[model samples]
Target: MPRHRQSLQLTRLKKAGIRSAAMLTLLTGVSGGLYLADNKADQEAASAEALFAEQELTEASVNGWSQHNVLERKVKAEQEAAIAAAAAAEEARKKAASTTSRKSRPGVTVKIPASCNEYSGNRAIGCALLLEAGFTLSDMANCLEPLWTKESGWNHTSSNGGSGAYGIPQALPGSKMAAYGDDWKTNPATQVKWGLSYIKSRYGTPCNAWATFQSKGWY
Candidate 1:
């Protein structure tokens, strides 16, 4: 072989090796750039997903709070209604208690008094007094018959030795009957008037007074 030909071949081989190394460096730089860009894209996608999840949680919290508020309002409304109903019922009970007439109670029958006479004694005077006081029912007379009979035996001047009670109604201190008249100590009519007034005020009716007398031995 000729020396010149061998040297030219060696030089061409060295140039080819240099060109391969330059191509390899260019390809490595491009691969690194592509990898970095892909990583950034993945990070952006993850951030977007996290933001969406947070928004969903916030919306759920708001909705839950709204529902709780509605439930609380409903309970408050119910409580107010119950309070109003109770107050209204109390007012109605008070009005009924004050306005109702005692005479209008059922099973009442008032008695009309017979004329005053020497034979009839204080009975006629007592009947007249009860009639004036609105105790005009037969059943009322029945209740009074037992009540006054136990107290004074229908006697106008009946006296209690132990208690100093006197009169048809057995007025304690006897002077208590003076509210009706000055003749309370002698007049059977005045005593009876004061007696009926007392029974009406304390017991509402003769029947109620009789009930008290039966239970407690006094009206």
Candidate 2:
């Protein structure tokens, strides 16, 4: 009776040990599978975070480039405007200078008429001297006025370098007028007196001298 009872207890103990080992193996496998799944989820979350950070950096670089381009364009535009303003100012200055040059010369603006009475400055002095020298008004207006105007424009300082002529009557070797007065070179009255005397001696009349000048371009 004792031998049979001991053998049955041993068999029960062996069956219990086998069931415990199987339960432990199942638990280990389930735990390992859960750990692997958790690790995969964490890796996916990290990849998403990295991609978002990279996208943010790219957008920031693009915005910075756009801002730089805008600033560059603004500077270029300002430079162009400054250059245009300088060119316009220079052109205006040149125009003002030309206007001033034209205004300064009174002879260039006043045209001499056939009527000697309307004359001013050097021409008026010549007219008075011609009347005093016994020349008729008709001779003075039609011949002497046109002749002197053509030769020297009544400018006492006028000279022709090629012909060696000078003053109101286009006197050749102008020093010849010094016979009339010491100030012949600068005084319109002295030049007028010398010119009238020369016409009386050589051509006899202003009309005759004018006729010669018209035909030959000189008298």
Whose lDDT is greatest here? 2
Q: TM-score of model 2 relative to the true fold?
A: 0.47
Off by over 4 Å in 2: 1-116
**lDDT of residue 136 for candidate 2:** 78
lDDT of 2 by residue, 1-219 (tens): 699999999999999998888899899989998999999999999999999999999999999999999999999999999999999999999999977765452321123345566767887777777777778778878999999999999998889999899999989989888777666778887788888889889999888999999999998
lDDT of 1 by residue, 118-199 (tens): 2256776666666677776463367876788899998878999999999878989888876666667777777877788889
Give all candidate RMSDs, comma-separated.
10.3, 13.3
Q: Which candidate leads in TM-score? A: 2
Candidate 1 regions exceeding 4 Å error are 1-119
Point out the worst 10-residue segment of candidate 1 by lDDT: 102-111
Please give the lDDT score at residue 148 for candidate 2. 91
| Candidate 1 root-mean-square deviation in Å | 10.3
